[model samples]
Target: MANIQYVTKEGLDKLRAELDHLESVERPKISQQIAEARDKGDLSENAEYDAAKEAQGLLEMRISKIKDQVANSRVIDASQLDSSKVSILSSVKIKNTANGMEMKYTLVPETEADLSKGKISVNTPIAKGLLGKVVGDIAEVSLPNGMEMKFEILDIKID
Candidate 1:
């Protein structure tokens, strides 16, 4: 069974657009290459034909993978989420208990996570530790480097 992924509406649209481009633009180009190669005769020794067939296989695999992703993706409705507790799509402000440093991050789906934009993946250790927690709660997280850290949840916002 494929894992169900939570995504925003924009992400779904992006996936759809990519799929359309692969089918409409790329598929025909590969077909044309194959046809041109076939006209050269010598079916057993045509490198161009083999290359084009390989390219077509890769393109079909990508299209099928994207189709599966689109089929399993579910859009998260931000307005329907509760702001009182941390969850997917929550913007949380936290303070490091050990160093007195403060940082804010928005917990987003894996596909939408961008560190430069202060968006973290919900599957991350920090985000997982903060899940289902409310403001003023402390979260204890274990990092992949074998280090433990504690962070205080200062605020939670959903938009």
Candidate 2:
């Protein structure tokens, strides 16, 4: 069975838009390249044709993966989620126990995790450890590099 993916409605729309672009725009561009390469004559020495074919293969693979993701993805309703504690779609403010530095992050699905936007994937170590924590709770997260970091939950909201 394929693993079910959870995403926000906005994330699902982005995936659909990407799929449409790949099929309607990129697919035709590759076809045009292939046709132009074919018009150049020699099949065996046609590097352009080979390159276009490779690109087409890669594009098709990407499209397939996105299609699968869209089909399996379930939209998570942020408004319906409880914001009293740290959870997916919750904006959490935490302070590093070691340095006293505070950082805020929103827990989102893997597809929508943009660190620059302060969104962290739910699968991340910090998020995993903070999943059910409330304000004033201490969370110890084990990072992938064999290190652990501790944080104190400062606030939680739905924003």
Per-prediction TM-score to the true structure, in the order listed: 0.91, 0.95
lDDT (0 to 1) per candidate: 0.96, 0.95
Model 2 is weakest, by summed lDDT over 10 consecutive residues, at: 77-86
* Candidate 2 deviant stretches above 4 angstroms: none
lDDT of 2: 0.95
- The reply for model 1, stretches above 4 Å from the true place, is none
Which 10-residue span in candidate 1 carries the lowest summed lDDT?
2-11
lDDT of 1 by residue, 20-97 (tens): 999999999999999999999997999999999999999999999999999999999999999999999999999999
Top model by TM-score, which number? Answer: 2
| CA shift of 109, model 1, Å | 1.6
TM-score attained by model 2 = 0.95
